[model samples]
Target: MNAKYVKRKSYLNFLQRHKDKPIIKVVSGVRRSGKSTLFLLFKQELIDSGVPENHIISVNFENMAFDELRDPQKLYRYLKKMTTEESMYYIFLDEIQHVQEFERVVDSLFLENNVDLYITGSNAYFLSGEIATLLSGRYVELAMLPLSFQEYVNWHKQNDRYKTDEAFFNDYLKSSFPYALFTDNDQELLEYLQGLYSTVVLNDIITRLSVQDVQVLEKVLATLFSTIGSLVNTNKLTNTLKSAGAAISNKTVEKYIAGILDSLIMYRAERYDIHGRQLLNSQEKYYVVDIGLRQLILRDHREDFGHIVENIVYLELLRRYQKVYVGKTKKYEVDFVAINDQQEITYYQVALTALDEQVLTRELRSLQSIDDQYPKYLLTLDQLNKTANYDGIKKMNVIDWLLQA
Candidate 1:
């Protein structure tokens, strides 16, 4: 079955903003994260915006027809044949990493004043080393992530108008990926996600890094997935792996973690120095790229609402383009410290249900400890009639905040 593609509003806005810039547009994310679909969407938008069909050229390296362009020289020659000096050209290259010495092709293309280039890659190594050196100041990266919770909700609302808590929960479990929204079958989606995960682990991580300890790397990833939202240290990860009979060193653990981060499978949120008002250097929290991937890795126990709250918080920060961190005060800890170019905001806590008096008190105490006045919020799953505002903090339901935001 062919999958229906939904237009991503955020990516479209990014393209419109940079349409006239000379900088190369680079869209990067994990495999099957809808990068290719976004490229096609942008291409359509360009055509609609009056870019002639002859002026826009797109090549997917994964396509069998372009398999011969694996050589840089051959790829450059093919592109040269399609482009002309009379008119400006828009070049969209998908999975450009498959080409050997891709930086040469990019550099050659960039030298031409008539071409505007856009490229997509599944891994960060695609932009590393020679490419970074060659196109140092000529590119703008547009990071693509898995479907945000808001996008996820928008996707399901298309088929069903009546949204009950149970229905939304079922949709959340099923259509976590943008691609999954096209299908209703759960088992088939799980199988596809499993295959996609294997490709990322094998082709993206292992092949790119060329590591001998595959088992150790897998163990590290599994550990990270299992311990999402917890503050993690390299030494502690090394100790845990050693205790599990993995025999991996702290340095190896650190390198493996970096590899995962480079692949965009996991993001590490650093600790913030609240007193000094700066980002701290040590002990950070890691969130998986998608909750579905976490569920795929850890199959049996998937109802970790605390981790889900963490995931939502991480996505919210990304959406707002906030510099987020785990915040600590003298008395208590804040869940997030979101700072942008202009303002600084502190977030307090998250819980699945704050029905209990003890849970409510515990969640509020974290926000109350902070001396400064910023927007403090307690995100909970409970849909209470009244919103309690203590001192300067506001307590609201997570679903309401997500929908409203």
Candidate 2:
């Protein structure tokens, strides 16, 4: 099947906002989360907005065509030839971490008067290490994520004749990466996801870090994936792996977990301070990049639908660029503490089904515990009842809420 065009309106807006800025627009996300595709889309937007095609210089370092330009000096000279002083030049470099000494080339291009730069990479090391120091205060990092449920819905609406139901569509959430939505064949899609996972493990994590103990890293990742939406600690994970005969140390486990975070395969949500209103240091929760990969790794029982709901909620908050955390009050605990630049906070509670009386109370109690007047919401699969308010908190069907945003 031909690749379907799923419009990523949010990312398009981001590009349009930062088009003429001198700072580099750095896009970072997990592997195959549509970073390259979004870059192409932004390029097309620029062309449509009246920029000449020749003024836009694009390069994918992963492509064999640029293999010889691995050295920073050669890359600098190549770009110098393409750019001119007369007009504004837009330069795009995709998967730029594949090139050796890439920071030097980026730094040089940024110094050029006529260039507006954009780059994409799959690893956090691209931001955390020398590149960050080299371009300090001169870049804006746009963290990308897999398709939101709404994006997935719109994508399906474009081609498929059969309209997918909520329960059926929930299966698509099982796979966290957006590219998997392109194909209809289940086996082919699974195989493709598996291959992408392996590539990320090998290329983005192990090879980039020069990690020696692949077994220990794999064990840590498996443990994290299996325990999604639960509080986790390095010491506990280290002990568990030791019991399983992995012989991994706590310090190494911490490092490996950080590596995983850097690769964007998993995200850590720290505990939020309720009274002092700061991020707490202990017992942070981790969520996987894609739910489907989580299912693939833990093939036994799929009984943790509540945790899956939590996972989906986490991704939605991330899609909005909200800083999310576990919120604890005196009497209860909120599932997520979403905060934006305005210091505005929203309390969210997620449950698979709030139909049961006990389930509804348990989810609502957390939001009630917070004495503040911030917006409180309980998101679930309870769609038959569409009451806007429940005990002062907003009651929203998770699917409806996702589609709305």
Candidate 3:
């Protein structure tokens, strides 16, 4: 089945805003989160705006045909030779981590006046170590993710039945990877997720980290995946695995978790002390990159739908904010504290349902504890009043909040 690509306007807008600027455009995301497709869409937009096709030089290192070009010198020569015209040449390199010393190629291209460089990678570490120091402030990174709930809803509103809850259920159950849209059935989707998960683990994690014990790594992943939205520390995780029959050290567990985070399979949110105005170096929470992948890894995770909803809310915050943290007051905890590019802050509390008076009060207490007057929100699945305000705090349906642009 041919997959219809939804125009990811947010990411596309980022590219359009940075078009032909002196800075390099770097797209980073988990594998199959539509990095290549985003580049393709932006390239098409350039062509539509009258940029000649021959001025675009695109290469995916994953393709065997580009095997020889994996050498930094050959790749540099090829790109240099491609820029024959006096106008700008748009160059996109996909999965560039496959190339050794890719920073050199990227650094060399940045010096050319007529070259506009854009690159994509599945591993976050590719931007660390050498490339980071080399490119310092020379490039801007547009971190990408799989489709948001709004994206899912917009894409399926006309093609399928648009029951709000059902649509969300389908998106949550099937998978959020862009390619999952073309899958015909549950079995096909599961197989696709399995392959995607294996690729991330085998290629991005195990092989990249030189980890030898696959079973231990699987255990670490299972533990982390099942505990999304909960505080985790390496020592505790090591103890838990030891009791469960896996013999692993705390350092090893730490290394494996670092590998997992670097691979973009999961994200860590540090605790921020709201009153102290500083980050607390205590237990940090981990959220999986995609909820559907969580489901696949922990089949029995249906029991914690509340945390699942929290996980979804966290991912949405990530897409909307520059920095997200688990907010901590002197006496209470807020679900999320989002800070934007303008340095504005927002506090959020997520719950599966706040219909019960007790649950509602409990959820509100955290946001109320924050003394600052920054915008505060309480997001829940409850739809009774749909929208309401509590002491200047806005309470709205999580689904509705997600759909907001």
Candidate 4:
């Protein structure tokens, strides 16, 4: 099937905002998350705006057409030859981290004044290590993800209306990988998710780290997927796995968890002690990158709707804010602590269904306990058109909140 022209406006807007800037535009995300498609859309936008075709250069390292340019020196020489001193050259390098010494190549390219560079990579560590020092302050990183709920609704517009609760339940069960939009059968979707997960594990994590005992690593991932919104640590996970017949050490478990986090398969939210103004190391929460990946990995994780709701809220917060953490007050816990570049804070509590008074009270107690002037929110599945404020906190339906933007 041909790739759909799903215009992810948020990411495309980012590129447009940074257009023609001298700094490198680094697009990093999980595989099959529409990174390549975003590049295609942006390239077309440039051409539609009357930019000359010959002035633009784009290449995917995985393609055989660029096989000879896999070396840093050769890639550098090729780009240098294509670049000119007059008009600007727009360069898009897909999966550029595959090349040897890619950091040196990008650093080398940043020197030319007439070229604007954009590159994509699957590994988060590629942008985290010495490359940060090499290209510090010379680039802006735009982290992309699988489809958001808004995009999910957009894709379903050609067929069923995915806005209703029944339709959203099905959407929630999906991995939201852009490619999954082309598949309808349950077995086919599951197989696609399985293959995608394997590719990420085998190539991105296992091969990249040279990890042996792949079975144990998968078991670790299974444990993580099953408990999306719970507090987890290496020691507790090792004990849990030991009782389940997987005899892995805490140290090994720690390494595996680190690898998963670095692979961008899942994200960790540290506990921030609100009143004490400190970070606690003991019980950090983990959110998988996509809910569909969680459902596919766990096979029958539908019953844990509460954590699934939390996972969605966590990812939405990430997409809207620059940083997110688990907030802890003296007596209660907040589901999410979102912060922007200006250090402004927003506290949120997410619950699946909050019609019951006890559940509603519990969800709001944490946001109420925090004595701050910053914005507070209570996000639940209860669908009431709400413009009301409760004890200085905003109460809104999670679905409405997600689709608002």
Candidate 5:
């Protein structure tokens, strides 16, 4: 069944701004995060803008029809034949990692003056190693993610599925992936998500990394998903796994974690010392790309609402900033430290509720310790005291903050 298209405004705006520029456009994200859908939308935009439909050439390497193009040399020759010097060609290569040594093809096509290249990959290694070195400053990456809270709400409203309670958005009753909106029942949504998760694990991670023990890798992933928004130590994780009868070493645990990260299914936030102005390498916190996926792993502990909400906040910050870190002051810890492309920093503290004087005071301490003139915000779920100002820190509702344009 074909799913209805929801306009991804933020990503569309980014593509619009970078259109026809002298650099390659790379879209990197987790599997089923809508990279292909974004390309379809942008291609239609190009056609509507009178760029000529014949000038656009797109191929999803995952399709069986393009199986032979998995050869880098053949793929390069095919693209060269499709593109001409007389007109501008927008070439989109989806799931580019399916082709072996794809960097050679990308680098070759990049030299064409009349060709504008845009590629999408579900794995981080698509930009690592040779490709990264080959196309260093010649590419601008748009890191795509699943739908934001605002997009989710807007989709529901536009599709006549609107609800006034707003609890569904916070509780995540439906998966946040774009295709989730097409599902009519929870059972169907669960099945779709399960299949998507399996493909990413089996195809993206295990196949790519040549994982010998699938059970061990899954156990490590489960541990990471259950402990979201908390600092993780490899030694302690190894000990915990050993207690559960998994014969794994600390190094193995680290390897599995790195593999999961490279798959783009999860992210790690290192500790940033706010006072010392340096990054601390130990006990970094991890966040899953989608809360719905984390729910599949940690099914029995759904009531752990605090960290779940914090995970949501972390993903939102990632969408906004170039770098998002767990901030550590002299004695306190800020929830997040977001730095944008222009080097502007913002401090945020997230809490389920801060109505109690002691609770509000504790959340405030972290932001107050940062001796900077930058903006500070306290995001909470409290309905009554959603908006307030304590000293210089501005407290606002997380839902409101997420819905911001």
Candidate 6:
């Protein structure tokens, strides 16, 4: 049974390395992005490492079985009562945002000498400023995401055989969520994704925010999702929605985007001025957290292949824990400015394909403009033979980049 679980090696390695430290491990991500599954795998790891079953307590707040403990006070009391005799207890709370004032409970648990706390929140509500104030300098926030293309491929290879490159391309477009590897029927997968999208919109956004104009919000979403990887702020978005028959103010649009952001449904990438070494004030790009969710809501996946590649590149940078930004050169734009843990900066230009000589040169121009010798790359759908260096910038196949650890 444990073998059936796909261990997210890098993420789990992070958790395992930080094991039993005096900090709460908080895994936050979009709904159904596999937070609970990761926690289960970690819990199983604990069991296999010879931890007594009685010493570990795991609860999912969404489960009806845990309904009685949804209250913060009751949950606190239940855990307090269960481990009265334990010396070191590992407590895992899944979807902890569903619990009222959960940060208070987490704070209380942190006060205990014996408790090692881990909680998962599907929305940004879990990591609000108040929680940071409550447990300052003491919690590990692991921003999890849906499975990567490599993870999906490995999962499928374990269960069935396939042509690697073909499978990778299929995953790049259709298999948007982690659960995609668990099912073969496309329609059923879309249905599951749609249901999850609704849940994210309703619970994490509308219901949680007490939004009245659901249609306006939907229109706002339509505007955003339709233009992923492009630049459009609240003002432009508001105007677009008004033209679409939903009259909403820029202020309202701002609020809606904030709410959308808080739900983890979409992420904003601010612009970095490569010349000035500062973040620009406007024209930030927005990326939907998962391609599957976009496919589920928009009903067409084939049209936006270029932006789709950009979006995939964005998430891959995030998965690798790189600090990413849209790079602004003097006269051209770099697709991404990725700074790793070592503070090394690199510029990347992402495109669907640069098979044509003109297109290849166009893709390389921005990186070519940067005179400093930081690593610059041109990434596309071109195979190895098709990829070649231009003026010291490395040309790589996007699929090859995604497969790398």
Return the lDDT, model 4, position 22. 84
lDDT: worst 10-residue window of model 5: 165-174
Model 1 stretches astray by more than 4 angstroms: 1-3, 160-162, 346-348
- Residue-wise C-alpha lDDT for candidate 3, range 237-303, written one tens digit per residue: 9999999999899889999999999999999999999998899988999999988898888887689
Report the lDDT tens digits of candidate 1 across residue range 57-128. Answer: 989998999999989999999899999666689998999999999988998888887888889998887898
Worst 10 residues of 6 by lDDT: 166-175
lDDT of 4: 0.86
TM-score of each: 0.92, 0.95, 0.97, 0.95, 0.97, 0.96
Tens digit per residue, CA lDDT, model 2, 43-129: 888888899999999888889999878777888889999996668999999999878888888888888889999999998887776
- Per-prediction RMSD in angstroms? 2.4, 1.9, 1.5, 2.0, 1.6, 1.5
Q: Please identify model 5 stretches exceeding 4 Å from their true place.
A: 1-3, 171-173
lDDT for model 3, on a 0 to 1 scale?
A: 0.89
- Candidates 4 and 6 compared: the better one by lDDT is 4
Give the per-residue lDDT of model 6 (tens digit) for 1-405: 534666688889979988989988889998888898898888889999998888899999999999988899999999999878758899999998888888889999999988988899898867888877887898988898888877876776776657767566766577557777667688888888878888989988899778998988988887788889998777777777778788789888888899999999899989999989899998899999888778777885468789988999899988874689999989998999988989889889998888887988798888988888899988888764546877789888888888888
Most accurate candidate by lDDT: 3
Candidate 4 lDDT over 1-405, as tens digits, reads 123656798999999999998889999998888899999999999999998998889989989999999988899989988886578899999998789889998988888888889999997888877878988999999999888887777667745544674476466557678877778777898899889899999878898778888988999999998988888877889998999898789888988888898889999999999888778988899999988788877776688888988898898889999989999998988889899999899999888766787977887889889888999988877765344577788888777788877
Give Cα-based local distance difference scores for all models.
0.80, 0.83, 0.89, 0.86, 0.88, 0.85
Residue pairs with backbone atoms closer than 3 Å in model 6 (clashes): none
Q: Which scores better on lDDT, 1 or 4? A: 4
Summing lDDT over every window of 10 consecutive residues in candidate 4, give the lowest-scoring window.
157-166
Which ranges of candidate 2 are over 4 A from the true structure? 1-3, 160-162, 386-388
